[model samples]
Target chain A: MSGRHRLRALGALVVLNGLIPIRTQPFYVVYLLASPLSFLFFISVLSSGAFVPFGVTGGLILTMLSAGTGLQSDMTHYRQDLKFQDIVVASPVEAPTYVTGMALSELVYSTPGLGVFAVIFVVTGLANLQSIAVLVGVLLLVWAFASALAFTLATYLRDVRETFMFSPLISLGLSVLPPVYYPIDRLPHWAQTAALFSPTTYAAQLVQGSVGLYSLSFGHALLDWGALIAITAALFLVAAFKARWKEP
Target chain B: MASAVVAQDLFKVYPGSHSRTPALDGLSLTVPTGGVYGLIGRNGAGKTTFVRIAATQLALTSGSLSVLGHDVAREERKIRERIACVPQESRPLYFLTVEEVVYYYLKMRGLPSVEARRRTREGLEELSLGEYRRRLVSQLSGGLRRRAMCAMVLASDAEMLFLDEPTTGLDPIARREVWAAIRRASREQRTILLTTHYLDEAEALSQRLVLIERGRRILEGTPGELRGRVRYPYRVALQEGVAPEELEPYGRVATVEGGQTLVFAREREARELARWALERNLRVSMGPVSLEDIFLDVVGRSIDEDTPAEDAEPGHDEAKA
Candidate 1:
């Protein structure tokens, strides 16, 4: 397919999965925002508002990561239940374009939830232009990494019900188990080092550093960005080169 | 006529997880460009596998295949660009309205806004789905959903269209509509590769067809040529109350459902048998051998015997069970 057609397919998919659903059933946005907003609410209440900024920052990353991980169920449904994959594979649309389009559609679905987190960021006085730029960068990388990982995993599934088993497990592994909603220094030395293996840890630390909730030297912040970029790039390579497009 | 699709000794074996039988074992045929070319087969006879491979949805285990003069394996992008398919298992996206499903599919195929809308409107009208155009596919009946899928592909300008059992769930009227659409496309000089086990459908629509069994070609020709391949040029079907032994003296006799006895014979003998039944006041129908009889003669079984229940429901009049 030519680049223009690929883009057109991508745009159409986004409108189909993202715009159409939200328009017809806007109430689903509540379900999307529930997890992150609840985490923000409870953490703020439990910590007596001392960690409100941390909660707000983590909510942003969590919301974006959830959108990425959500691709598993979306893609599995499209492939298994809807049989859209066969139709798409036969068309002029390339696999990478299809995958990228699906991933972006999920992100678009979470736009309303992301908007709530943006309001929280401003309310917490953590919305400077520089910090916002860094936070946006961190959220995009996290979303990309999670989306690539989820898309690759979705191809291995034979049934849509299998997604129910895997999507939440992936979300917990990528988001909750890391230091996304808590300061990394709070963990013991070994636990903190182990968390380093997850991309979400770097994303959380970057958000925290930008929002002034956590202290980080320039070198440490640079390392965090480097690690997040590297991990995301590696996952995207797998999604692009190794993901299943044609059946055996 | 040039070949639109050519498969040379194609073999497609599913992984161990799937059925042990090879989906396509050295199955080969050439589908000529323009008009309808039917791939008729019993259930599990590898028709869908061949269409999937030719349409670039699945890969062949061995041998060479090409579509529109491009290799299926090496030139998938080029092949995909020129062909559209309504696969056997395909369904329209339930979330989109029927019109949206067709319109967005065209848009995704890179059609401009005005052209896509025009074709979408026309496709829905052609398939008699215009009334359901604004309804979500989830709300439509299975037959309507199937028609929506057809509308999506039929509206496109692709050179070759792969319609795998496109009218399997449709009623007789809807099936005729689809047949008409296929005919129109053929009149426009588009090659349509259709797969169905409905003998009447294949006979009415396909200019040429191939009958396959267990992933191998048993017959390939025009309907007349295939009917000519049968040794018995006529058939005499005697309704109940006829003893098989009584008809054995005339020709090959086989008992079918509802206690109907089918006797295949040469034209003169068949005429004598029909007259004999008439003298006895027995119910009998005699005619030239049909495609179904030819299929039974070569394969040693009725096609319905092998067709799974879900492939064609017994309740539908068009099922011809």
Candidate 2:
């Protein structure tokens, strides 16, 4: 009925995120912080000094992973386990606001990934004002695109098991199969062509370009920017227009 | 008074293991504008499905349905603005305190923070959750969690409420507490549509009632009217020493605890039964049958004495989607 309700939903979403750290402390450590950071560390030791910031990419990508996991866990928990979807669906809140509020909440919950990136860059002497600015933009863009896609997919999946079973496959595939962990330029032409479709490839390129880690052609940068905006806008539109608020 | 909700030949066909079955099979019901209306049935009788459709949380497979004169299919937002639902089996899921759960839901329902807090505290006090207002929902026991969930709806000023088995898992005393809270929440402007497995619950709260079976409305009336409609409106109970066959001349007979109970369909039969009981040197009394008896009579037996589970059969999620 009012903008305040949207604000309340957002507030509740933040509170919901805050509670997660306290409730699942072990999960926060083992899966959220440790597992991803450990992988980033593993990748850091093997790569060249110039690529130590590649660890930041791992941290950055995995931090946004909660948006996808939230799609799987929180959406399923709200719909299946707690049966609270009806409560929201029956309210005056629009589906887009609910989806955006929840995605932003997961982003808030996974903010420590920012700290992970900060620590890696500071210790590795790779921190620069311009690179940090690019990293922030990439995080927000990737989260918006990925969360939109995740929200759209959740509209079709039936249960917690299905959401869970498919979500990690999506997040891991998005993170690992793209240039998030490796350089796109060194890969085969076929792999580079495929990576063009992934936003992370461009995101990695954008960050690396900002820090002079990779050579990005001006024309190529224009295409990357277009792909990021176009894909995100399209996904957001589909999620907003087609997400099922009630059973049809 | 205007009808608060109207459903005519409503159908909700859920995908099943092999074939499709209507959860709300040709069911039609009307709930008036004020006081409490009860929908009571056994498991899989489509009470929650009916409530879901009315609340605009699920679409009907066919036929017409509306809430507060707003079409369920086309005017969901208008109906949602006026109605609230306490969904069945919704535990206290959020990590908020008991009071915050109520307060925030009120906020989500469009109330200002101050009023939300005030109504939340009022709901908390009414439901006896005030003592535990500061406690997290997960910290509460099962009954208290249910109380918190009910308070989430009670804290709102919605014109109507769809409460699906609000007292399903409560202890007797806790149940009475919930009933009292529900009574306090009702006003002339408010309509309460609730489902229950407890006959006493229906008898206590409902001004009008509908008894559904497997998604069909088998019986509908005020509790007293329903009781009067019972096939065996008069009941005879004799000591355990008496046999059921001895009362066959009167009416239907069945074994009840500590007695052989006889049911009579008419006053003449009841009079004859009482006279026979007296003449045979038997200790017996004839009384008007209760709503529970009518429920048993309608359904051929009572099966709700067991715990109330909201149709948890496999592959039943399609309707709630």
Candidate 3:
């Protein structure tokens, strides 16, 4: 395929994903928000509610998990085929640069889903002017952290079957143990403390705080965002180092 | 001429579940700066492992390898900058088009957009892939995808090129086209190291050939030099009246028909034997020698001969390091 065609295919996928929320009604919205498929679905459904902090938290968690699954699949397939390593070694491209391109592509691919949720919130009278900037910041943070973690985990995966088996297990454990669907105060003190250690919990908290769905101190939200970014950066470095460009 | 590629006592060992099996064992060879070099080997003879290490896509367990005077271990980036490789059974990114695949490599090599475009166009034209430039790689046929891959490597403008089984699944015509392009590339001063199981291909293109069996170099010479080592004279046809036993006194003979016989004679006696047969009122014909015959003599096997099918996998050798 030509370069232009590949880019077009990616653009088409983005547009198709973006239109899903705009054309659907409550049934589709409900299915999206409650399903474990992708966080974007939950975010789209929750955008219709005036005070749905849990929905926003659920959506953020879902987005991270979905992105993780996507990264894991890509990494696993590449390892099994060995084509990725062959291309990297044969071409002049460096491993880190190739990974950076993949990350950026993920960000671009995720834009439409995030944009659709933004539009839904605006049109449904769910998001006020005060929360729009915060919503955008949370989306960016979720994407960066999710993509970085996926890239890092990919370094360890040797095949697609392992990735398929492992990613959902990790996502499922994180979903049940963290503040994705319920507020931290409602959980046991120890569970809440443990949730604090999960990156998805911080992301969920930040999304809820931004949309006015949950009551949180701005300082606490800022700290969560900072921690997420730092973790993403550190994971990125480790992934770059651990990637085996040459076969051993 | 300076050597384009050099290796000394190269070795590679894959850690097996129970114990390590050496993939390459004290293997060493050199290629002159120009012309094609063919690496011929059986399935488990370590050809792929050798190419992988030479391409700097795999690390050796021991020994030194250099390409264009750059050591593969320490000067990998420099060596990579000057070399291009077409790996066996490699495919392009599923989402990328043929043009994109070629352009991406050029861009990575620090070529400007204009130069990248120029090279992509030239490579596509050379490989007859210009029409498929806009199609997704996932949509192309096997042959076209292979062509696109070759174009991608060609666009890199590397000085040395290594192609591992470049025509493995290609049709006869497609294989010829690929060979033509390879010849053109060589004319432009690109040093090519090709590995193929096809004896005819090796004879047609390679100036020097190396035959490896079980991770060890068994023979290294020009096709003529290798062919010269086989002293058996090719047998020709004879009239139906000649009995097979009559030719037995001349050499080892096998009857093909009532009158015809195949005789394997020493190089010195072949001409005199043919003359003697003709004097006996037998119509005689002579056969020409080929690389296939020489390969059989040296390896004690034929490509067409069936061994246990399970022996197709590469065999393990002792690790040099």
Q: Score every model by TM-score.
A: 0.94, 0.92, 0.79
Q: Which regions of candidate 3 deviate over 4 angstroms?
A: A1-51, A78-82, A120-145, A152-162, A173-177, A193-197, A210-230, B17-21, B94-97, B131-139, B229-266, B272-288, B304-321
Let me know the TM-score candidate 1 reaches against the reference structure. 0.94
Q: What is the TM-score of chain A alone in each candidate?
A: 0.96, 0.89, 0.72
Which ten-residue region of model 3 chain A has the weakest summed lDDT? A12-21
Q: How much of the real interface does each model capture, measured as fnat? A: 0.64, 0.52, 0.32
- Candidate 3 C-alpha lDDT tens digits along B1-321: 789889888877653412234566788898888778999876656788888888888777899998889888898877776788888777776666788778766665556668779999999988788888988777888888788877777666789888888877777887777788888888888899999888888888888989876566778889878766666646455665566677666655543555455666665556777788778877776665567656665677764453232333232121111
Instruction: Evaluate model 2: give its lDDT.
Output: 0.75
List runs of model 1 lying over 4 Å from the truth. Answer: B307-321
Model 1 alpha-carbon miss at residue B312, Å:
17
Q: Per-residue alpha-carbon lDDT of model 1 for A113-137, expressed as tens digits?
A: 8899899888878999989899888
- Colliding pairs, model 1: none
CAPRI level of candidate 3? acceptable
Which should have the higher DockQ, number 2 or number 3?
2
The residue-level lDDT of candidate 1 at A143 comes to: 79
lDDT of 1 by residue, B1-321 (tens): 769988899977665423445667688899888999999888767788788789897767899998999999899999988888887767887778999999989888888788999999999999999998899888888989999999999999798999988998999999999999999999999999999999999999999999988778889999989878888878999986677788888888855677788999988899999999999899999999888888888888888776443332121111111
Query: Candidate 2 DockQ category?
Result: medium
Q: What is the lDDT of residue A115 in candidate 3?
A: 49
lDDT of 3 by residue, A40-141 (tens): 345446665433546544654565456555656665566445365565576555555555455555444344444455555566555766566665666566
